[model samples]
Target: MHPMLNIAIRAVRQAGNIMTKYYEKMDSIESKQKGYHEFMTYVEKETRYQMIAIILKSYPQHTIITTDNNTMHTGDQHVQWIINALDGSINYIKRLPHFSISIAIRIKGRSEIAVVYDPIRNELFRAWRGHGTQLNGYRLRGGMVRDLEKAILSTNCSFKMNPNASPYIKIIEKIFTQCADFRRHGSVALDLAYIASGRIDGYLAINLAPCDFAAGELLIREAGGLVTDLTGSHDYFYNGNFVSGNVRIVKALLAHIRVK
Candidate 1:
């Protein structure tokens, strides 16, 4: 593993340990809504703090961008860390055990490392640019479900926050008709990891933050899959939309989306 990626792995694991300490007592964690269909808890805040400390201890000069509503940048830097200390907060609060800690390192405008750790399953999904995606050190080649009719696609219901979900709903309805099935896992990071591991053939969503897909995007691409925004561009970091999968499935999914 690249030295930076190794540091990231250590960071995520330590953070996962912190989260797991609170997992069993999450029901008493005190929570609030961040927005429509969104939730946050004190656990997230504490975990983010510890994770940031771990990363900075190793590379204090790196820039850090996080979804905790915190952004820090200083000095000349070629590397930046994008993180979601706790992805799938709702699932975590609901005791679903499907949440994860996501961390991705972007160097000089290009993503070079990614890690998503599911504490419940003790599964770690990781990738480095030009290196294969791995699950607990085993390399993954992604899925081969090219035929749209037989592919399983995953998405999130965050469209509820959008003024009009009809257009997005239309896209889902169309996909349901053509694909074997679709899922809304509530964790965009895990959804994309599943895509890379071949557990799912594709994933799509809109109005997501950079922290939501940064790690997953690199994992999918490194695992021999493709990722892009609805516009078929690789600029999802700014656009906050995604459609990722094997080349054939992504193109097929894109053909069905008629975003107004």
Candidate 2:
């Protein structure tokens, strides 16, 4: 692992430890709503703080982007650390074991290192731009299934972000008819991680924040898959509408996705 990637692993593991502690006391953690289906907890705040603190200790000049808007710090350095200390707060609050911590380092607009840690599963998915993606320590080469009718697609649209359900619903309707089945695991970061690990063959979602998919996006690309917007563009970071999987399935999914 790269030194910075190793540091990220340590930082994420520290956050995971905090999460495990809170998992045993979910009833006491107070949470507030940010939107209809969006929420946060004191644990999320502390986790973000812990991650940034650990990261800044080594790269004090690097830019940091977390869910906390107040912690946004800009510097002359070219590296940026994007983090989501608690990726699935809703799931975590419900004592579901599907949440994760996402950490990624971008240099000059390119994601060079990425890590997604699922404490519940003890699965760490890591990737570097030119290097292959890994789960535990085994490298992934995407999924073996290429037929659209047999592929399992994953998404978060069922949660219905932004109340603009029409676009998402229409696109999903088309996908449901072709793909074997679909999954909504509540965590887009983990959904993308599943794609990298070949647990799922494809994934799509709209209105995703950069913190949610930045790391997993790199993981999918490094695992020999395609990551692109619904219109088949590489500008997923800007639009937050993305589809990713093995090249064949991604291409087929794009055909059924109506990019309104």
Candidate 3:
């Protein structure tokens, strides 16, 4: 294992311990609203703090970026550690046991290593650039479905009085009619990880931060999957609209997702 990846695994496992602890005392936890339909809790903050401490202890000069916009720039800007301490805060708040911690290391603006740990299920998904994705030490090879009609797709859509809700709904309606089934899971990290693990055939989401899918993106790609925007372009990283699946399934999905 790479030294940096080892440190990341340690940091993520430590953060998982914090999550499991707070999960047991959910009633005593307090949360604050950060934005429209977004919540943050002490658990998320503390987990990030602990992970940062562990990481900086080894590489104090590396840049660290968190979902809360608290960026730590110590020295090197070429290497960035993007973190989402808690990916599914809504699920965690509601005791849904479907949240995860996502960590991705970008070296020279390229994703080099990634990790996504689910505390509730004790499942750790990881990938190192060219070295394929793994779940609990087992190699993953992504989904095998070659057509949307036989594929199980997952999505994360915001429908709470949003201006783009109409187009988003239209995209979903079109895809749902063609796919085998659709799931609206709360965590994009887990959804992508599931795609890498072949548990789900494809995924779609809109308006997401880099921390939400950075780690999982590498995982999917390493596991032999592709990630693209709804328009089948590579601009998902810029537009925050993501679609991912095996090659054929992704192309099939893109045909039905029309946005203007």
Best by lDDT: 3
**Cα lDDT of model 1 by residue, 1-260, tens digit:** 69989888988898898888877654442333333123345678788888888888888888888984368545336888998999988788777889999999999989999999998899999999998899999999999997999999899865464557777777787788999988888898999999999999989887788898899999999999999899898878887888999999999988888533
**Superior candidate under TM-score, 1 versus 2:** 2
lDDT of 3 by residue, 1-260 (tens): 98999999999999999988877766642433343133346678789999999999999999998884468555698999998899998898788889999899999989999999999999999999988899999999999988889999998885455676877887888788898999878999999999999999999898888898999999999999999997788887678899999999988888777533
Candidate 1 stretches with Cα past 4 Å from truth are 27-40, 73-77, 158-162, 258-260
User: Would you give me the overall lDDT of model 2?
Assistant: 0.86
- By lDDT, is 1 or 3 better? 3
Q: Which candidate wins on TM-score?
A: 3
Residues 1-260, candidate 2, lDDT per residue (tens digit)?
Answer: 69999999999999999888877766543333333133346678788889988998998898988863234767645898999999888888788889999998999988999999999888999998898999999998888788999999998887454557886887888889999999998898999999988899999888888898999999999999999998999999898888999999999998887444
Every model: Cα RMSD to truth:
3.2, 3.2, 3.0
Off by over 4 Å in 2: 28-40, 68-71, 159-163, 258-260
What TM-score quantifies how close candidate 3 is to the native fold? 0.92
Location of the lowest summed lDDT over 10 successive residues in candidate 2: 29-38
Candidate 1 to truth, TM: 0.91
